[model samples]
Target chain A: SCYLIPNKMVPGDSNKECTDLKGNKHPLNSRWQTENCDECDCLEKEISCCSLVAIPVGYDKDNCQKIFKQEDCKYIVVEKKDPNKTCDVSQWI
Target chain B: SCYLIPNKMVPGDSNKECTDLKGNKHPLNSRWQTENCDECDCLEKEISCCSLVAIPVGYDKDNCQKIFKQEDCKYIVVEKKDPNKTCDVSQWI
Candidate 1:
């Protein structure tokens, strides 16, 4: 469920930290969510990130559409034609 | 992010499997989600379960209410009076 990225640093730098895709520096043991909504942890040797959003996989894909809401790290499944209406879908891991 | 439950078994049983809260048995290395949307893995000594649904923490609680949809394992933040309206809120880890 999570991906690991080896920690890389400047050649002359001595500090140990994780750098995110946006070039944000985080101290070891720190946790954060990326702009892409990936929940990441700054570990000793690498950065581990897992998706905070779960894409709708069991929905009626033909008649429904999945929209990602970045502000909340969630997905909304609604009718394709009438987005105001939510579509019922089975839940899965 | 996950909680571990020690694997318990019958006094005379020898198989190594995890028994979930619902009394379902899962073999080692197997993974599943509970009825409550907890993603779980059956490990060697315990069952690790993490909530698949992330509760809205940075939302406007005064003007919005979070409605949990059991069918989809997600929360919908809507207006206090008009449930059809979605409220804008800041994102947080």
Candidate 2:
């Protein structure tokens, strides 16, 4: 079985604190949340993960960059959480 | 910064070998394949990691299972890899 880890950040004190001039507080700490829980700060970078089986692996933890490609390596299955994307939950089973 | 690892599997020898009558060969090593490289095998367990910022956290590698919930924890936003889903590549920013 396989699943996802939606990495996201949240404000300390539950956003109770005030924000800076840019309307952004000192965002801190990142934890694993519930199912598809995407209600926090965006990832610190732009990242994508394609089905490794379909594409070549591009992983750089130093840069925190991961890219996933299509099976034939012709196209990139940009994993942007789109309805037509290829992130089938059935794969988890 | 954050990124994704498309966990997949591929045939040991690039799927060149044949399979049993059940169409199942002896699945071996699990390596990090291409972008969203979903070819070789699954993650062995059912795991889910939500935006801890928006929801609670649940991580159990022993059971190989993870679950993510909604902000209010009322609904279960199943991470099925759908376009309508909330996975934004920009989050990696």
Model 2 stretches astray by more than 4 angstroms:
A1-26, A29-67, A70-93, B1-28, B31-93
Model 2, range A32-81, lDDT digits (tens) per residue? 22112212322342111122232223432232322322223222323354
Distance from true position, residue A12, model 1, in Å?
9.7
How many backbone clashes does every candidate have?
0, 50
Maximum-TM-score candidate: 1
TM-score of candidate 1 against the unseen true structure: 0.45
Mind giving the per-residue lDDT tens digits that candidate 1 earns over A43-86?
A: 87567677776756587877876654556767677787886899
DockQ of each: 0.02, 0.14
> For model 1 chain B, where is the 10-residue window of minimal lDDT?
B1-10
